[model samples]
Target: MTRIDLHAHAFSAHTAPKVIATLLTLAHRACPGFAPHGDGTLPDLLRAEAAAGFDRVAVCNIATRPEHHAYMARFLTALRSGAMGEEAARRVIPCVSLHPHDPDAAAHLKTLVALGARMVKLHPYSQNIPLDDPATIRLLALIRDAGLPVLCHTGHDVTAGEDDFAGPRRVVNVLDRVPGLRLICAHCAAWRHPETLDLLLGRPVGVDLAFQPATGVEPIIQRFALEHPLEHLYFGSDWPWASPAEHAARIASWGLPQDRQDALFGANAARLLALP
Candidate 1:
């Protein structure tokens, strides 16, 4: 069976060390006691994937601020065009991003598609835009028409502390507003609120099993796999912050049939992204 990790974040080695350090600082602040396992580089991430038995990963690229859009676009171009290197190009399915506040956000989405991005990544907390923001809705509609799914960071991001931007209600509300938007709620639908799973039933939205909190919500994960559309259930490890292997192991322990476990760990995401 194919294996693809639908969510992982790593920086190009060409990235400046200072930027990596600053991002790491904020990430560490999110969980002060837990130290990440890998250095914030593509090579480090690739090694981790190998150790975890994943075939490839959809590396989520982000532009945290409006001003960072152009810079991230360049990196996205590099990764997709194999400018990052043959290894990265072959192993990565680049999930592109744009800041909601950017004046050319629509055009940015076009460029990302033109650059061959397979999926999109959005963060309400990090990008400082609510899911219901007019600009965000507009962009999401465009993404839907483009036939691309977006991995939306839902609920809270401890690093940024904006709790209301992507709470479970807002995430569901955006679905009503956008109609058929393919929004994949990150952090296991909504962190610390596994009950939100009841709200998500029957919706076509996607959800990833990731982060440390995910392991604690064993009942939610098990029920989600058993009841929901398995194709929308992705295996995410939020790598560096947590181990991809740990997430995979948790899924393996669920006593699901081999094919079901295969879909949860990798095949479903492969179908969604159409990644090689």
Candidate 2:
């Protein structure tokens, strides 16, 4: 298996502005003794990936505001094209994002494809767009046509737990409406939600293993990671909010069969990314 981490994030000084700082603060408040394992930088992410024993890591970044898209797209292009640096070129798989409400959404998608982007990320919580909104459906269809897998932020988030805008109910609705989408719902398809676990088990969408231990979701993570079919699961550290090494260690201790472990660690994601 390729040992690829399907979800993680890195940011340059230019990208870690006020919005990024606010998110970090909220994560700390949500998880006790919380502090990032890696600094918010590409080099730090590479170091973390190495520590986690990941052979390759997909670097996903977001731009909630349209004004930031140009800057973010330039950064993503550098990463996907392997222009960031030698280390990143060796191990990083770049993914891009587009705010669903961006008036120029089509143009942004075209730009990402032309830039050789391998995947996409969307956060309905931070981006304030409902999963079933007309705009989001249209964009998701375009991404499916482009053959880009999407990592969508789903379930209750620390920043706005009360906001059910990205809840699993809505996610499943979108899944039903937008057939054939290579969509990976983030945060273990949100086990905290009542219908989420059952819905996730029934749905065809991919689920990323991004369980946060500090949030008292360890048992839930154990159940989901162990029970979910190999082909439907992918490893996601949700790094910066959690540690990649800790999450990887937790799964390793499960004593799963080699092939199952391999599938959870990377094979499924490699197939989704179409890596040879």
Find the candidate with the highest TM-score and give its number.
2
TM-scores of the candidates are: 0.89, 0.92
Task: Tell me the spans in candidate 1 whose CA falls farther than 4 Å from its real position.
Answer: 13-30, 214-218
Candidate 2 lDDT score relative to the true structure:
0.78
lDDT of 2 by residue, 149-238 (tens): 999888777776566777778888888878999999888656357567677764577788786666666665666677777787888997
Residue-level lDDT of model 1, residues 86-191, one tens digit each, is 9888888878887777778777777778878889899887788897889888878888988899998876665665357887778777889888787888775555
**Each prediction's Cα lDDT score?**
0.76, 0.78
Residue-pair clash count for candidate 1: 0
